[model samples]
Target: MSPLVQPRLINGPYDDPGLILDFRHARRAILFDLGDNHALSARELTRVSHVFVSHAHMDHFGGFDRLLRLSLHRDGPLSLSGPPGFIERVEHRIRSYTWNLLDERSADCVLAVAEFDGTALIRAARFPARRAFAREDATPPDLRPGLVHDEAALFIASAALDHGIPSLAFRLQERMRVNVHRDGLAALGLPVGPWLNVAKAAVREGAADDTPIVIGEASIPLGRIREHALAVGPGQSVAYVVDALGSPANEAAILDLARNADQIFIEAAFLDEDRDIAAARRHLTAGQAGRLARRAGVRRMTPLHHSPRYLDRPDALRLEAEAAFGSEP
Candidate 1:
């Protein structure tokens, strides 16, 4: 099945840690972080409906001001999720500016801030940064671990991790695997028609009603339509993580989500030579990021969030990380 979660690193090691996940097919697109979002213009920025932030660090959240300015008048609600104090920080940013210019504008923005408390293992979302919605204090409520989004073609799961402070990792999954049942269609003397689209939707929705399926004047009971006959296997899963340290407690959480991730995006803010510095700063070195990716059994590792000092020889840092993880340069 074709991958539904399209990930593009707008900025990071190559730029600055901005990712645009196009779940266009699912009718929703998500932006991971908001560092240097030069890759996304005003028009492109409005395309995203949700923004998941790892932290409030400057490099991680500097682009939010511009994003807010662009999305202030959009039709849809712009949900923003992040660590604790995120709402206050965002409110402060907004209050810092005078709304006299924006009062005339239709600010249809409904910002939702989700904060994770590691000690409680719970996540809470605050609407308008004041009103609290649902709260989960149990095992870190599975934010769509299974059929979370339930859109026609996509499902998304969000998991929290410790990045010095509270942080989160999101996994976007395509719910259905689409495949042509050539043999079944041929056996039934049924030429592939647009009705197959309805059947695929039925399979995804797990619809039980035996609605009559019209195929060129022949009405066939939908119950007679077998799923495996026209269905494929599982779809793809994409996981994104950033600004996290390699700690035993967080390691398991990170690995569980990243294991088998087709493309893993992680932060590597320091080099192996600066391991001590990385540890002190509660950040991950390139080598550590690579090793964790290998340990997690990720297929592809894109180490990003490099410190500015390595700007001159970024390739050197990348190679060092790959070598440490036993990956081909």
Candidate 2:
């Protein structure tokens, strides 16, 4: 069956961390971090309508200018969600640039920025790219614990982690997974088109089975299509975590937010031998990352964000993590 979201690491374990989640059958995409994303092509960058930032740390947020530059002419508003001070930081970034030249042209870009204090949205702002990126306080929706952003296809959840400051670990979960039966469609001589996407949306939105589906000149019942042409199941979920300390509170929060996630992309900034250093620096050791994954009951785990000191022996970190997860490396 086709997965609802395809997740790919934007950079390697030792490089700055970032993840791009591409919706399987849509033009939209979600960006987990803004870190050194130079590797992503312009087309891929343009597809990112929502960017979820862990924090404003330089390594995790340095790519914001590049994203802003590439998406300036995109059709829709770009939304940025992050931990506290996010709105002010976004405004500051925009204020650093002069937009006098943009006054003559039509405004085409709008930015929606939201700041989260833990799981609550404390502030929000919006601005048009052509208006010098001016800030306008916007009324945000009623706060929901752990929910960062909600959409028809999926929703994002986050937990505050300690990195000497508030760094967020995120999860992206699809509402449901709907698989179209290609063989059945071929057997019925029905050509697949945008209607299939509509059907998937209808299921996610909990539409009645008797809902009508338009195909060519005929209207068909969704129940008939389900009986002959579709398979439905639980959707995909992926959690991203990095630069967090291995404290009890942080561990508990991470475990709760990432429980039973299909895959977890977590930081392993140090080997077990450097546990003290890792603790002092507010980062996780490989063993700690694996332990968290095991405790969280994640189906799969990838350890990332290795320290530059381990450049010559990066495999050691993975080995340590594997051992801690009760798997031989």
Candidate 3:
């Protein structure tokens, strides 16, 4: 089965911390942080539907302007979720820019921002290009706690950790995976088209087997397709975490957020020998990151956000993380 999301690191471990999750079935993407993202193309940033920021640190959110600039002329809304006080920060950033040239004829795109306080969004707002990106109060959606974004297809869960401040960790959970059999479609004389998306949604939404799926001029029962052409499988999830102190509270939060995730991108900012420095900076060591991912039961882990101190020995971080990941916590 084809995976729905393709997660990739936005920059080298020592540069900035971020992830770009490219969607496989649609022209959409989700950004896990807005750090220096020169690595991502303008087209890629324009397709980003939402951004989940870990914190307000420069290394985590300095690239906001690039994303905003790329989104200005787009035809779709750009949504963003971040830790407390983030809504104001977004507004301030927009305010710092001159919007005198912006008008209704400019674009219909809106910048929807939400501030999540660890558990759930505390406030939300909308800034439309038509209104010159002015801040307007909006009601937060009714969603379960810890869920920053929720939709029928997937949901984003977050857990805030201590880093001298709240640094959030996120898990992108795809609701379900739907696989289609090309051979079965050919045998049934059905041509490949957009109807497959409808069928996949039906399966994801648990539509009744007898539900009639209209494809072209003919209506087909979902059960027949379920048996001959389609299959349902477990969904995939990717987790992102950075800059959190290595403490029991943070560990518990990360473990819960990343539990059984297919892959986890975590920060390993220091070596075990630099434990004192890491603790002073509220960062994690390579060993700590590995053990945390292991305890979370993730299938694979990518150690990132390496401090420049080990630039001469890049492999040291990877080796330390791998060794700890393979051992018991």
Best by TM-score: 3
* Tens digits of per-residue lDDT for model 2, 1-329: 67777999999988999999987778878999899998999889999989999999988999999999887777569999999988888888888987777742754788999987776777888987767677788976564687898877678888889999999999998778888898977876778998988877887777888999898798888887776778888888999999998999999999998999999999999988898999999999999999999999998898888899998986988888878877657
Q: Estimated TM-score per prediction?
A: 0.78, 0.92, 0.95
Model 1: pairs clashing at backbone N, Cα or C within 3 Å: 11-16, 11-17, 12-15, 12-16, 12-17
**Model 2's TM-score against the true structure:** 0.92
Writing each residue's lDDT as its tens digit, candidate 1 over 60-121 gives: 79998888777666655576766667766776776676554433245445565555443222
lDDT score for residue 296 of model 1 = 83
Candidate 2: count the clashes: 0
Instruction: Between candidates 1 and 3, name the one with more favorable lDDT.
Output: 3
Query: Which ten contiguous residues of candidate 3 have the minimum total lDDT?
Result: 320-329
Clashing pairs in 2: none
Candidate 2 positional error at 59, Å? 0.7
Q: For this target, which candidate reaches the highest lDDT against the unseen true structure?
A: 3
**In model 2, which runs have C-alpha deviations exceeding 4 angstroms?**
186-198, 211-219
Error of 3 at 250 (Å): 0.6
